[model samples]
Target: MSPRRDDVIVIGAGLSGLMAARELEAAGRSVRVLEARDRVGGRTWTRSLRGHPIDLGGQWVGPTQDRVLALARELGIETYEQFDRGRKVMELGGQRSTYRGLLPWVGLGGLAELGLRVGQLELMARRIPLRAPAERADASALDGQTVRAWLDRRVRNPKARAVLRIATEMVFAGEPEDLSLLFFLFYMHSGGGFVRLTSIRGGAQAQRLKGGAQGLSRRMAEALATPVEHGQAVHAVLQEPEGVVVHAGNRSLRARHAIVAVPPALAAEIDLGPARSERRRRAEQGMPMGSVVKCIVVYPRPFWREAGLSGESISDGEPIRATFDGCSPDLSFCALVAFVIGGSAGGFGARPSEERRALVVEHLVRLFGAEAAEPVAYEDQDWSQEAWSRGCYVGLMRPGVLAEVGNVLREPAGRVRFAGTETAARWCGYFDGALRAGERAAQEVLEAMRAEVPGDV
Candidate 1:
């Protein structure tokens, strides 16, 4: 059979790729989306656990993430505030302390240092341009150092340093030593500084979808003129003079342009023929995906609330780093959401499922009470183990890598363009970023094909 034809061929059915296809469709261009997984939403996934929906992927949204928020509103998806009432728990130096509000009970000295360093990092982050962070004058110096080195050089207090480390690992899913200082600053700034990104009341983790974040992609997929072809992993591409041919399984397609919407790690699996550049290879190799395991446990009731606990916990403990109260608005569905991030995720996810669940229950028992030992249901998504995604949250840029390959990230590899959360300007690792990146890639394709139209989508 003749290869399928379209104005644009989109790889991956995640929000970014689907958004790109949406924009293309809105612009009167035909599109065909190919996804490796047999579902939409990409990293944002949700499933029913014991008659209750559980979000096991990127699920949070806030007012600051205007793109995702706007999309949610347009899609008629309701948003609810994250549950954070009663007392919060904090474990430091092997001591557990229950506190309330944003700042934990980490002592006056550590608190002061925390405020100082956070403010300092925020200020530094503001100086980095969103679109072209590498082009900034001091980019070289900033990119040359890792967050670990920068923290050791700048932060004096151990408690403050440890807290910052934990926060970075939780957010980026990469250890301090694995991330570039410049990239870290840019990422935090992209989400409106450290305070906003880390806070809950009015920050990145502020809200949740009534159903789940994955619903965004599901709705988009359903509304599209063409259905997304699932289980079609684009393994090879050949850029012809007139168009491009994308190969997935026994199928192939020729299009004026192709948008590679997967993460760098997955993108590396696609053979770009002889035109693939060494710089692109280096960028893909240097930028590694962060590790994370999103866990959920459901019980008969929200017992933590009965004890006047909010179910939120932040700790420097091994394996488990953070957790939050994840019950329904009516309090009928009681569940504890948790995360094992960074280097710890590697080891934690390697354990047998039963052991992992046991460890989480044990940790919660200590943080909450004896009630945590028994749960009606348990589930988790080890993002690192996913074949299509490889990892979660977003890609990580190591020290010295950004300075060299950052410029080439958004540029087209011949007839192939790129889009994902990593290519976004603001909220780089969030759903908003993913949408923005998709829109940007679609616009690029339109401009190249001379079909550009203003106010599209």
Candidate 2:
């Protein structure tokens, strides 16, 4: 039988791929979307816990992430602020403390240290060109250094260092030692700097979808004229002089253009042949997904609130390093969402499931008191273990790689264009970034089609 044909073929049904497909549809072009997983939404997932909806994956939306917020509104999805009404708990270096407002402020000394270093990061972020960061004059120097090495050289306060370490992991889901300083700066700047990325009231964790973040993609999928093709993971994308041929499972489809919207590593896995661009191959090898385990513990009530606690905890403790209140906007159910991230996520996730739960309970007990002992239920999503997604949140660029080849993943190779959160210059690791990337890739394809066939766009 002849292969199916479409104007454009979108690989991966994540936010980026969906967005790309949606744009192509808006432009009156035929589009076929293929997804490996049976479901859509990619990294953002929301499941039920004891009859209450709980986000198992990426969930938060914040200030300056206007694109996603607008999308939610357009899709008729309401959003609410993340519960941050009381004291935040901190367990650092075996010491436990509670404080109100944004940070747990390491100490007056640590405060000064954090302030100066964050200022430096923000300043350095402005220096690197957003489009082709490798072209920056100081790119070589900044990209060559790991975030860990840079911190070790200047940050003197141990507590402040620990806080920054946790913050970096929470943001990038990669250990500081594994991240490039230049890449870190770019991520921070793209998301509106250090404070906005970390804080609650005006930060990245500020707001969440009333239903769930995944609803954004689900709604888009429903609206698209053509249904998303799940369980058809593209194994190869062969660009041809006429168009493109995509092979997935036993099926082959031809299209005028193709958009590859999965993570850097996964996109690299698709057999693009020896003719594939060297820079894309390098990017695929250089970028690895960040490790994380998002655990949501359902409780009978918001117990920590009774103790004048906000349920926000940051610790140097094991098994669980950070937690936040995971209550619904209407306060229908109470839950505590915790995270095991970065370098420690692997070891902690390696233990038996029950053991992981016990450790999380124990850590929460230490910060929020005995009330945290008993929870109605416990659920965790180990992102690294997921076959479709080797990791979560975003992909990390190895040291010196970003400088050598700047944003190569975004470049279109023949009839193929790429779109993922990593390729977005704005809000690079967030859903907003993914949306922006999808829109940009779709526009690129649209322009190319118009250039080739004139007025078809």
Candidate 3:
């Protein structure tokens, strides 16, 4: 049977794939997008709960994330500041404290120590280039050590160590011991700085899209000249000298170029013929996605706000590691979102839906008093359970993996290219990075095609 042909075929209808398709179509190339899920928006998902739109996936947009912010505006999506007024909550060693600003009632000495560590991280991260992390002078030594090992040697204060550990879980969705220090530095550098990566005002968690994060992807898909085909997961990619063939269940698509924009772990499942190099294959095997269970609890009102709380909290010992105010912009409905990440996510996500919901509600009640027990709705999306996406946020490099095989991440295999947030240099694990990578991959494909046969594009 003859396969349908196009100029470009994109596997995955996520933001990255959609953006790549948009660019190719704008360049006068025929394109088609194939997605495994019934809907678009890979890691970024928006859903309605009790008549209020809530983002179950990646939602926040930082000030430094110019790419996603600009794209949102271009798509006519508005943004709003996160509800971060009043004092924030912190629970450490079973003690609860409320404080205004960023310190969170920690001692002056602890705050100074934390600040110094953050400064040191930022300074070291600034010295490492994003594109060539493995080529650094001390890359081998740094990659050999874990973030936990680095913290153990330098951080003496218990409070400081706890704070850093929590930050590690929130950012990477993995424990400090699970990821390499070199990768952490490169990630921080790519996101601009440590402060920008963690803060709420100027950091990566600053603003929320007016509708939802997924709205941007929906708009981009809508604007595309070629429609995205749903429930068509590409199982094999056979790359030829002049083109590539992508095969899903009973259907196959042939294209001049192909973009495998799914997660690295998922991409590893596809058969790429002789084009996939050993280095690329080994790198994909080593790159594991971080675990996270995003839970949202809708309430009658922003009760924590009236109690002089900012609806944000971090815990050293809680199933829900972090909490944030997910209320609507119009203040009509209230929602509190929490993240169960890392090892806890694995345990909690494995439980039945009712059990997980009860656990989350119990934790929220403990944090916000008895008023939190009664929620209008309790919804959670366990990314680890999804067949298409093994996990959430982004992939992580364990100790010794980055130094050995980090350079092959974005390297193309014949007519096939990669595009995802994980392959991005700037804002490596965010929606912003996803957009940058998509655009970059599209440009690379266009350049390759033009170089191969002049005026082909």
Give a tens-digit lDDT track for model 3, residues 176-227.
Answer: 9988999999999999888888789988999999878999999999998878
Find the 10 residues in a row with the least total lDDT in model 2.
Answer: 1-10
Query: lDDT of candidate 3 vs native?
Result: 0.89
What's the lDDT of the predicted structure labeled candidate 2?
0.88
Candidate 2 all-Cα RMSD: 1.2
* Per-residue C-alpha lDDT of model 2 across residues 1-457, encoded as one tens digit per residue: 1366899999989999999999999999999999999999989888877887788889999888989999999999998989898899989888899988665678799988888888887788777677778888888899999999988888999988888888888888889999999889888888888888988899999998977888999999999999999999889999788888899988888999999999998988898875478878888888899999999988888988888888888888786778999998767788999999988889888889999899888888887888889988999999999888899878899898898878788888888999989899999989999999999999999999999997664
- The reply for model 1, stretches above 4 Å from the true place, is 451-457
- Candidate 3 error regions (>4 Å): none
TM-score of each: 0.97, 0.98, 0.98
Worst ten in a row by lDDT for model 1? 448-457
Query: Candidate 2 versus the native: TM-score?
Result: 0.98
Candidate no. 1 TM-score? 0.97
- For candidate 1, lDDT tens digit of each residue in 238-315? 898888999999877899899999998788889998867888888888888999999999999999999999888888
**lDDT for every model?**
0.89, 0.88, 0.89
